[model samples]
Target chain A: MIELVYDVHHQVTFRWLIALYFYFTGMSAGSFVISTLAYGFGLEKFKPAGKVGVVMATLLLFIAPIMLLLQVGWPIRSVWNHFTYLNFSSPMTYGAFLLMMYPINCLIYGYFMFKGDMKRTKIFGMIGIPLAITVHGYTGFILAFGKARAFWNTALMPFLFLVSAIVSGLGMMIIILLIRDRFFTREKKINTELIYTLATMLGWMIVFDLALVFCDISVLSIAHAEAKEMTHLLLHGELSPLFLGIENLLGKVVPMVLVLTPKFRSITTITIASVLVVIGILFMRFVVVYGGQVLPIV
Target chain B: MAKTRYAFVIDLRRCIGCNSCSVACKSENSVHLGVWMSWVKVIQKGEFPNVSRSFLPLLCNNCEDPICVTVCPVNANRIEENGIISTDPHRCVACRYCMAACPYEVRYVHPIKKFVEKCNWCLHRVKVGLLPACVEACPAEARIFGDMNDPKSDVSKLLAKHPVQVIKPEIGTEPHVFYINLDNDAIEKKRKVDVL
Candidate 1:
C-alpha cells in the first residue's frame, strides 16, 4: 500500500465560468441553427421560431465570451492578442474568428428577417449554419486539445458538443415558442402542435446524445489505466452524483422519456421535459469542464 | 549548428527530501504562497518495519516537443534557442490552457497577476553563468542543471552514467527532466496528488 505524504494542488483550470461559457455558446449555437432551419434550409414549419431564434442566438453569444474574459485574468489583452498574434494550431484561435463572425451574421440575419426581406434573410441564415456549428464545435476542440484530460481528449467531443447544443436549443425553442404565442402575440394562444413537434425532435436528439455518451464511456471504461480511473470517477466516484444523477438521470433520460412517450405528451409534461433539458445541458457542461480535471493527472 | 538541449537530472538517491530546491526556487522566482513552480513529492510505502519513503522533485519537464507552446493562443510561450520554454508575462492572457495541457502539472496562475508561470530552468541565472538557485542551494547536490549537448556538463554526464527515467513518456512529449533511482511508488500512488 502507498500513501501520499505531501503534494500541492492547483486551482482547476476551467471551472464554473468556463462551464457557463460553454452553456451560453451551446445555447447560442442551438438557436442560430434553429433560426437557420426555416430560412436557410427552407423548412416552412420552423418559420415562427426564425425571428426569436436569431435574437436569442445573438444575445447569448454576446454573453458567452464575457464569462471567458472573467475566467481569464487579462480580458482586454486577450481580445487584443487574439487578433494581433494567433497560433492557428490552437483551437481557441478558431473560436476567436467564429465568435466574431457568427454574431455579426446573426445580427444581419435577424435584421433581414425583421425587415421582411426573405431573400437576404435566407442568404445570411445559410452562412450562419457553419458559423454556429464551428463556434460551439471549437469549444469541444479546445477541450480535446487539452490532451492531458482523459475525458476531454476524445475525438468525438466536437460532435457530442454539437448534438447536445442542438438538443438544448430545441428545448429552449419549445418554451420560447409557448411564451411567445401565449403572451407576446395579438392572439393569446399556445401553439400545441409546434411545441409537440419541437418536443419530439428534442427527444430523438437526446437519444442520439445518450448513444454518443455511451460509446464514449464504454470505450473509456476499459481503455487504459488512467481512462479506467476517469470512468470510475464519473460512474461511482466523487463526481458520480453530478454525472450520473443530475446530468444523465434528471437531465437527459427523464426528458427523453417524457417527450418520447405519447401518453406523456401533454403540455405540462413537455414543458417540464424542456426545462429539464435546459438544466441538464448546463450540468453537462459542468460535468465536462470540471469532471475532466477533477482527478489530478500528476 | 544544432540547438543546445537543456536538460535537468534529479539524483533521487541523493535527495533526502529536504525541500531546499523548493524553497530556493520560491525565493528566487518570488512565487506566491498558494502555488509552487517547483516542489518535492513525498510518498510512504509498506507498513511498520518494512516501511520506506521516497521523494520526487516536481518541476516543469520543458519537453522537447512542448505542448504548451503548441496550444498558446496568443503565442506567449516560446521555445528559445537554448531549449528553455519561456512564457511572456505581457502577452499571456492567463487562459490556463497550458496548465491543463501540461502532463506534469508544473504550470500555475500567479495568485495576484493571474498570468500562468512555471519553472524555466532559471534562464535568468543560467544566461549569466550562474547555476539555478535550486541547484546552488541543494546541500545534497541532487539537482543537476546544464546543457545536455555539452559532454562536460554535469547533467550530460549524470544522464549518460545513470539509469534515468522520465514520467509519462507515452504521451510523446519528449520530456527533458531525468530522474535517478526514481521510486515507482512516488508516482504510481492512486490518489489526488494535489490537495485543494
Candidate 2:
C-alpha cells in the first residue's frame, strides 16, 4: 500500500469563524426565502412564520457580516476593497454585494410587514426572493470555484448548500415559533398547521440534502484518487465519527424519521427533531468548510 | 517586445536540502515565526536499504493562470506586466481567499502586517538585477531563475536540455516552477499519519 503522508505546510488556512459566517449567511438566506414564499407566493399557511422569518433573517444578516469581518486580517481594508476594488470574476465579490443588498431589502420588507402594508411587503418579497437565493448560493459558489480543494470542487455544491440552507431555516423557524408560543404568546396557541407544514418541508429538504451529499461522495470517490482518499477520510478516517455519527445519524436519519412518522410528529418531537437538524446542518457546514481543507493538494 | 515570463528551474539531483534557502527567505523578508513564504518539503520513500529522500522546495509557482488572482474578491492579487503574480499589501484585506485558491498552498496571512503574503520571486531583487535570496543562499546552486521568454536565459536553456515537471500539472495552473529529475513519489498527495 502506498501511504500518502499529510504535509504540515498544507494546514487549513480558514477556521471556525469562516464556517460560522457561512452558516449565518445561509440561515439568513433560507429565512428570507421562507418569508418570500408566504408573502409573494400567497402561501397563507406560511403567513405566521413570514414576518418572523424576515425579522430573523435581518438579525442573522447583521451577525453574519460581523463573523466574516472578524476573520479578516484588515477589516477596514476589506470593507474599502470590497466596494472599490471588486473583481467581476470572483463569486465572493458578488457575495459581498449580495449580502449588502439582501439585508437592506429584508429590513424594508420587515418594515412593510410590521406596518401591515401587504401590497408593499409583497413587492419587496418578490425582489428579496432572488436576492436571498443568490446570497446563500454564492457562498456555495465561493467554495465550488476554489478548484484547489478536491472535496469542494463540484457543481452539486451550490444546490446542496441551497437545500441545507432551507432545512436549517425551517428548523430555526419552528424553534422560534415554539419559543414564541410558550413564552411570549401565552394567550394564543401556536399554529399546528404551520408547524406541520415546516416539519414536512424540513423533512423533504433533508432528503434532498442527503441525496446530494450521496451523489457528491459517490462521484468523487470513483474518479480521482486524491478525491477518493479525501472521501475515505470523511467516511472512515478521523472525521468518521463527526461525519457519520453527528452529521449523518443524528442530523439526518433520526430527525428525518421523527418528522416523517405520523405518530412522532407531535410538536415536542418535531421541536427535538428540528434542533437536531439544525445541529446536523452546522456539522455539515463544518465538514464542507473545514474538512475540504484538511487534505493538502500537493 | 514580448513581456518577460519569469520561471524557476530546480535541479533535485543537486539539492542537499540543508534548508539554507528557507532561512535566507525568513531573514530576507523578515517573515514571522511559525509562518513561512518558502520552505523545503522532504519526502522519503522505499524500505531500509532502498530508502531514498527527496527535498521539494515549496514556494509560489507564479502560475501562468494563477487561481489566487482569479479568486481574490478584491483586486489585491494581480499579474504584473512581467507575468509575476503579486499581492499588494495596501490593497489586500487579508481575507486569505488567495491562500485557499492556490493549489500549491503557498500563501499566508502575515501575523503583523495583516496582509496575505507569498514569494513574488523577490521582485525587489529582480528589479535591482540580483537573484532571489533563496537562489543566492543555495550552496549547491540547485535553483536557476530567469526569463523563459528570453531564448538566451538560463531557464529557457535548461528547459530545452532537461525533462522538467511541474507540481500538480493535472490541476492545470500552468506553474512556472519546474522540477528536473524529481521522484514521482515526492509529488503524490500525502496521507496524514496522525491527527490532533
Candidate 3:
C-alpha cells in the first residue's frame, strides 16, 4: 500500500571495524578467564593454558582498541579528547577506563605468574577477571545504551555479549593450545584430556549463549513495530545470509552441536568447532553492529 | 525573562513535496558532498490509479531528552541555552554513537571532515536573528520554526491550535519537531534500494 520513493537511506553507522574490535575483545576476555582458572580458582588441570591464555588475552586486548581508534575521525586527537572529555554516563566512557586498566592488570598477572609469584599472580589474576568482563561487557552496554536500535536496546545485550565472549575465548584457546602442543611443546603428542575439558566448558557456555540468543529473538519478534522488522530483516530478509545462515546455523548451532554431542566430540571435530566458533563470534558482532542501523529507523 | 526553547512545526497540508527545505538546509550547512542534514522522504501510497505522494520531511528533532547528548563519548553533544542539541565540532571524534542512537537517523558523518554532523535547525542563523534556511526557503511556509517559550512566536501559536505529532513519540525523546497530519506510512516503508 505504501511505497518509499525518496528517503535518505540510513547508513550502517557502526561497521565491521567495530565488529572486529568486539571480536578481539571478546576473545581477549574469554582467554583472561581461562588463564584465571588455575591461578585464581585453583583448577590445576588447566595450568598449562594459564600463561598462554594471559598472553593471548593481553595481546588481543591491545589489538582491540586500534579498531576503535581507526573508526574515529581524528585518531590522535580522540585519544587525548576521550581521556579529557569524560562523559561518565556514556557506555563508551566505561570502555576507556576498562581498556586501559584491564591490559595493565593482565601484564601484571602474567608477570607474577612467570616469576613464580603465585600469591601476587593470584591477586592480579582475580582483579583482571572483573576488568576483562567489563572491558568486553561495556561494548554490549554501548549497543544497549544506543536505546533506539530494536535488538541492541535489549537488557539481554550485556549478558549475550558476555557469554559469547566466553564462548569465542574458549574456542580460540583450544585452537591456540592445540597448535602450541603440536609444534611448540617438548612432546609431539596433543593434550586430549585438557582439550576435552576445555571443550566441555565451551559446550556449556555456547548452550547458555544459544539460550540468550533464543530469548532475545523471541522477545524482539513480538515487541514493537521496529522490533518486528528487525526480526524479519535478520531472520528472513537481507540480513538472513549473515544472521541465520552464518551467525546462528553455522556459527553457533553447528559449533554447539559439535562440541556438545558426545559421539561427535573429537580432536578434529573440536578443532573445527573451535574454528567455527571464533569465526561465528566475529559475525555475531558484525550482525549486531551492522544490523542495528542497516534497517532504517525513520 | 523566559529561556529560549526552539521548536519546529511542519504544516503537511501546505507542503507540496518540494525539495526547497532539503536544498536550503544542505547549502546553509555546506553539508559535505554525499551527506544530508535535512531531507524529505517521499512515499507513494495506494495502487497506480489511486496513488498519492506522501512526504515526510526529515531532520533532527533536537529532542528535549536528546539521546545523542546522553550517549556522546567525548561530551561533544550538548543542549544549548536555546534548547538546540548542538554538537561541539572540534570535540566530536566521529564516534557515530549518536548516529546509531538517534531514532530519527538524521545524523551523518561528514565525508571530508569526518565528524558526525546533523541539522541543528540552522543554529548559526537562528542565533543571528534569521530564520533557519529551510523555513525561509519554503514557498508555502510549511516549515515553521520559532521559540516555544515565547507565547507570541509562530510555533507557539500553531502548537496551541493544532494537534501536532512527532515521528516516534512513543520512544519518549519528546521531539521538539511537531508535524500536522503526519503520515505513519511515510515513516514505516523502506527505501527501495537500501545502500547499506
Candidate 4:
C-alpha cells in the first residue's frame, strides 16, 4: 500500500532559511568575540573593535528574529505568541529573557568601550565581560537544548561557538584593517606583527573546532540509528557538498594549511589566510544550522 | 496554590491538518499577512508498508518556566496572573533574544512594529470567557479548552484518563499542551540533522 501523508501547509524554505541562519550565526559569533576581547582578555589596546562589536551584537539581536520570521513565513502574528505565556518551563521563555539581557549587556559594554571617561568604562566593564560570554554561550545552549537534533546535542558546542565567534571577529577586524591600511591609510605600514599573532591564534582555534567536529561525528556514528541516519544525510544528503567542500576543505583544511605553513609567513599571507578562515567559518555556520534540519530523525 | 493559572490543551487525534486553526488565529488576532501567530506542523514518518504519518499542530507550548520571559532585559514579556505570556509593544525594544532562546523556534519580531510576539492563545477570547479562535474553528472537534485547575472541566477529565505526551519532554519545559496518539518520532520527523 502506498502511504500518503497530509499536512496543514508547508511554510518553510531551505534556501532562504539556510542563508539567513549562516548570516545570523556569523553575526552572533563575530559580535561576541569582539566584545570578549574588550572584556574577557582585557585587550585594552583593541578598544575600537569592542565598541563596534556591541553595535554588531545589537544589529544581530534584531536580525536573528528576522531570520526566524523567514523560517515561520509570518513575521507579524507569529511574534505575538512569544508574549502569550502558557507555561514557564519553556526554553522559548528563557530565550526571550536572554534576548532582553543580551542587548542591555551589549549596550552597556558599548557605552564603556566608547566612553572616554575611565570610571564609567570600569563600571560597565565590570558587568559587560561575563555578560558577553554568557550571552554568546546561551546561543549554543539554545541549540543544544533541542534534544531532538543530535547534531546540536553536545556540551562542547557552546565553547566551539564561543571560539568560532572570536576567530571570525578577529578575521573581520583584520579585513577592516587591510581595507583601511590599503585605501584609507596608505602611508601607514601594515601591522604584520599583530597579524602573525592573531593568525596563529586563529589557526589553533580552527584546529580545535575541527577536532571537536571529528569527535562529535565519531561519537554520533556509534550512538544509535537516529544519529546514523543523521550522519548519512549530512555526508550524502542535501548539504553534503557544502559540508565536504565549503565547511571541510575551505573552512578547515585549506585555511589551516595556509596559516600554519612556513611559506605564507608574511603579513599579506596572514591576511589572506585569515580571510579564507572567515569564509570557512561562515560556511561551517551554514552547515550547522541547515544540517540540523535536513536529516530529521523520523 | 495561587488561583490564577491559564493554559491550553490540543487534541492531536482529532486534528485534520486543516489550516483553519492557523487562519482563525491570524484573523482574530489581526496578525499581518506574512506573519503567523500560531502554526501547525505536519510530520510524516516510517517507510513504505510500515509508514505512518502524524499531524502535530505546533503553537507556543507556553511552558511553566519560560526561557523567553527571564531573558528579556526590558521586561517586554510578562506572565499575567491568568498565565498568559504577553509582550508590551511599548516596552519591547525589538530585541529578538526571546526568539533565539526559544527551543521551539516559534517567536519572531514584527517587521513594522519591531516587537517580539508569539501565540497568545487568543487573550481577547480568553478575557471574554470564550475559546481561542483555533479551538472554536476546528472542524474535527479536535481542539479542547478549559482550566487545568478546575477538576470538573472537560480538559481536566481528559488529562486524568488519557496518557498524553508533550513535545521535547527532555527539555523539561513542562508544556501544558497534551497530545494523544502522538508517535515517538513526531518531533524527530520535523528535525533536520547536519554534519561538518
Candidate 5:
C-alpha cells in the first residue's frame, strides 16, 4: 500500500467541481426540458427558452467535459481508461454512461426541434424530457452517494442540481429571448408574467440551496473532522472569497435583486444579471470541487 | 496467478529536500512540460518561532486499493503484483476521473501525449534488476523499493526497525511511501511537509 497523508495538500480545488458539473449537466437537461414546454408540448410562452436552449445546451455540454478533463491530470489517457477499465461501482463509469446517453437523446430531440417537426414528434419530446431529467439527476446521485464529502453526501443534491438547472436554464432562456427580441425575432418575446413565474421558482430553489449549504456547514463545523476542515476551507479559507463573494452575491443575490427590483426590470439590467448568475454558478462548481479536496483527511 | 505488485517507501528523516529523486524521475521519464511523473512537496508547520519544514518526494503510491483504478471508465490503470500502478497511454481518453479520484494529485497528464502518466517506479529498470532511477539518484537515500510481503526485503526490515507514517492514512488508500520522523504538528494540521 502506498503511504498517503490524512491532511491538506495541493490537489485541484474541487470545492465547486460537483456543483459545476451538475450546473452544466443541469443546464443541458434543463434547457432541453424548458424548450419542450413549447416545441414539444405546444406551450407558446415556453418557446422563448427553447430556441436558445439548444445553443446553450451545446455550450454547456462541451464545457462540462473540460471541467472533468482539468481535474484529471491526463486528458488523453482519460479517454482510453474509460473504454478499458469498466468498473460498474464507479460514479465516473456511470457518468460516462450517462454522458453518452445524453447526446444521443439531444440529437434525436434536436432533429425534431430544428427540423420544425416537434409537433409531429410528440413521442420523442415526451420520452426526451424524462430522459433529460434522469441524465442530470443521476449526476447528482453519483456525488450524493460518496460519503467522503459532507456537502455532497446528501439526498438533496439531485434536487439541488435539478433546481439549479431549471433556474439557469430559464435564466438563459430569458436572456436569449431578450437577445432575440433585440436582434433576431420578437415572435418569442417573453412577457414579464412568464419571466416572473420562472424567477419565482428560481427564488425558492436558491433560498433552499442556501439553506442546505448552511446546514451542511453547521454540521461539518460540529463534527470537526476532515469534513469540517473542508467546510472551513469553504467558509473561511482560500475558497471564502468565492463562497462569500461570487456564489452568494452574483449567483443568488444579484439575480434576486434583478427579479425583485421595480427599477431593475429593464432588459439590459436582467441580461447583465443573467450573465452574472451564470458566472456565479461556475464559481460554485470551482469551490465545490476544489474545496472538498483542500482539507482531505488523507 | 502471476502478480506484478510494485511499492515504494520514503524515509522522511533522511530526506534532504534536495529534490534529486524528482529530478531523476523527470529525466528518466522524459515527462512533458507542465506535467510530472514524480514530484516533491515541501511542507511547513507550526508557529513562527517553532516552524519547521520537510521535503516530501511524491509519485504514484501504486496503492493496493488504487482510487484511480476504480474511477476510470476505461481500464487504463492496473497494478502489478510487484506493486506499480501502470497507465496504458493508448487506452486513456483523458477524462481525468482518476485525477479527481486520487487524493495525492501525483498523477499528471503529458501535455503532448494527453495520456494519463505518472511515476512507473522505473519498471523497465527494475526488470533488469536495477533500482528505480529516483531511488538510485536520491542523494539522501530517502527511498527504498521492495516487496513488503517478503520479510527479507530491505523495506520490510526498515519498517520493523523504525516508526513511520504515510501522508494521508485516513483516506484508507494505503499508500506505499512511508515517512520516518514525520512532524506531528504538520500531520495534525494536515499541511504540506514542504516549508520552503
Candidate 6:
C-alpha cells in the first residue's frame, strides 16, 4: 500500500496582485493587437475602434508594470537591478525589457493617431502587433519555463496567453465602445455592423480559448502525475467552483452563446457577454498563477 | 586542482526524529518563527502494528546545476566558488522566481528581511572550519558534511562504503545531499495536503 505523507512546505509566493499584473498586461497586449487589425491591416470592420483601442492599450500598458512594481520586495531597486543585474536566461528579464518598450511604442502610435497621421499610425500599428504579442506572451513564458511546477510547464502556455489576451482585449473594447456610444456624443451614428463584427470576433476567440484549455487539461489528466494531481485540484478539488463554474460556464460558454445566438445578439446581451468574458479571463489568470503553486514540490 | 564540491550525507537509520538539528539550525541562523532554513519532516508509514515513523531532514540540496541561480531575473542568487548556492539580500528584488524555480521548494522569502533566503550549508561557520549547526547538533551523528573533492573527507568515505540515494534524482539537478539506508516508500510518498 502506498502511504501519503503530509509535507506542507509550499506556500503561494505570488498572490492576487500578480494575477492583476497578468490580467492588465494581457488586456494591454490584446487591445493593441486588435488595434492592429484596423490601423495596420486596414480592416474596415475594426476601423471605428482604432483610436479607442490604442488609447485603452496605452492606459492598460501603463498600469500593468505598476502592478508588478507593487509586488516586488524592493520596488525602488527594481529599476536599477533590472538594467544593471539583468539575467538573459530568465524570461522575466526579457519581459521587463518588452514591457518597457511596448508602452513607448503604443504611446507613439497613439500620438500619430491623435495628429491624424494615418500613414505613420499604420506603420506604428504594424510594429506594435509583434511587441504586444511578446509582452503578454512572455508572461506565459515566465511561468512555463519554471519547469518546477508541472502545471505551468507546457509548450502551449505562450499560445494560450496570447489567445486569452486577444479575447480579453476584444471584450474590453466592446464594453468601452458601448459606454462611449451611450454617454459621449459621436460625429457619426454608432455602427451596429461593427459591433456585430466584434461580437463575432469575441465568440471565436472564446471558442479558441476553450479549445486550448481543454487540450491542456486533457493532456495533463492522462499523463504526468504532478500535473494530474493539479488538474484534479482544478477540476474536482476545492478550486472546482472557480475553474468549472466561473471560468468555464459563466466566463466562456455563456459569453460564447450570448454573442453567437441570433436572438441574443442585441447590444445589451453583447455588453453582458463581453463583461463576463473579461471577468472570466481574470479568473483564468488567477487559476493559472495560483493553481499551479497549490501542489507541494517536495 | 579540482573544484571544491561540498555535500551532505544523512544516514536515515541513525535519525531518531528528535528534531535537535532543526533547533540547532534555527538558533544558529536566528531564523524567524513560521519559517525555517532546516526542518525535520516526519512521515508515518504502514498501518497500526506494521506502521513505522521516519524522519527526513529537509534543506537546500545545494544543487550543482541550481535552477534558483538561473531563474533569478536580477542575478541575486549565485553559485559560490565551492558550489554552495547563496542569495544576496540587497540585490534580490524578491520576485520569488527562485522560490518557484527550485524543484526542491526549499527557498523561502524571509518575512523580516523580505529577501529570498535558503540554507547555504552554513557558509559562515564553514568558513571558520566548523561544521554546519545541524551536523554538529545531531546527537546520533546522522548528518555528515565535507568536501566531496577530498578523498579523505568523512562524507566521501561514507559514500564509498554505502549505497546512497539523492532525493528526486530524476530532476537532474545533481543534488549534493545523499541519503543512506532510506526506503523508497519514504522518499517517493506524495504529500496529501494542499500547500497554499
Clashes of 3: 0
Model 6, C-alpha of B156: deviation from truth (Å): 2.0
Compared with the true structure, what per-residue lDDT tens digits does model 5 show for residues A1-298? 1233222234342434455666788778777777777777888866656656766676677788776666554556565556566777667677776677667666676677778885544666777787778777777766564444555656776776676677677667666666676567646554666666566555565676677667666776777366666666667776788888888777878887786577767656677777776777667655655555554423
Give per-residue CA lDDT, model 4, range B99-175, as digits (tens).
Answer: 54565656666766666678878877888899899999989978877778878778888888888888776656677
> What are the runs in model 2 whose C-alpha is more than 4 Å off?
A1-11, B193-196
lDDT of 2 at A201: 88
Q: lDDT (0-100) at residue B148 of candidate 4?
A: 82
Per-model TM values vs. the true structure: 0.98, 0.96, 0.97, 0.65, 0.76, 0.95
Error of 6 at A76 (Å): 0.5
Evaluate model 3: give its TM-score. 0.97
- Model 4 off-target regions past 4 Å? A1-158, A169-199, A215-234, A263-271, A288-298, B1-7, B12-20, B38-54, B108-114, B185-196
- Report the lDDT tens digits of candidate 6 across residue range B1-196: 5778899999999999888988998999888778888887767777778888777888899998877777789999888888888789889988888887788878777887788888889999988899999999999999999998889999999999999999888777889999997766666424544534
Q: Which regions of candidate 6 deviate over 4 angstroms?
A: A1-10, A186-189, B184-196
Q: For residues B110-190, what per-residue lDDT tens digits would candidate 5 score against the true structure? A: 676666677778888988889999999988788898877777788878888988888777767788887777664443434
- Please, what are the lDDT tens digits per residue for candidate 2 over residues B137-162? 99999999999989999999999999
- In the range A144-238, model 4's lDDT, one tens digit per residue, is 65454567767877776776766666666677656655677658666566556667777787787778778777787787566676677667766
- DockQ for candidate 6, C-alpha atoms: 0.56
Return the top candidate by TM-score: 1
Docking class of 6: medium
Candidate 3 per-residue C-alpha lDDT over A1-298 given as tens digits, one digit per residue, 9 for 90 to 100: 7776876655568878898999999999999999999999999999999999999999998898999999888889888888999998898877888888999999999999999999999999889889989998899999998877887999899999999999999999999999999999888789899999999999889889989999999999999988888898889898999988998888888988998899998999999999999888888998898787766677
Q: What local lDDT does model 5 show for residue A31?
A: 79
True contacts kept of 4: 0.16
Sort every candidate by DockQ, greatest first.
3, 1, 6, 2, 5, 4
Those runs of model 3 whose alpha carbons end farther than 4 Å from true positions after fitting are B189-196
lDDT of each: 0.89, 0.86, 0.89, 0.65, 0.68, 0.86
Q: What is the TM-score of chain B in candidate 1?
A: 0.95
Residue B96, model 1: lDDT of 93
Q: Write candidate 6's Cα lDDT for A33-81 as tens digits.
A: 8788888998877887888899999999898889888888888898779
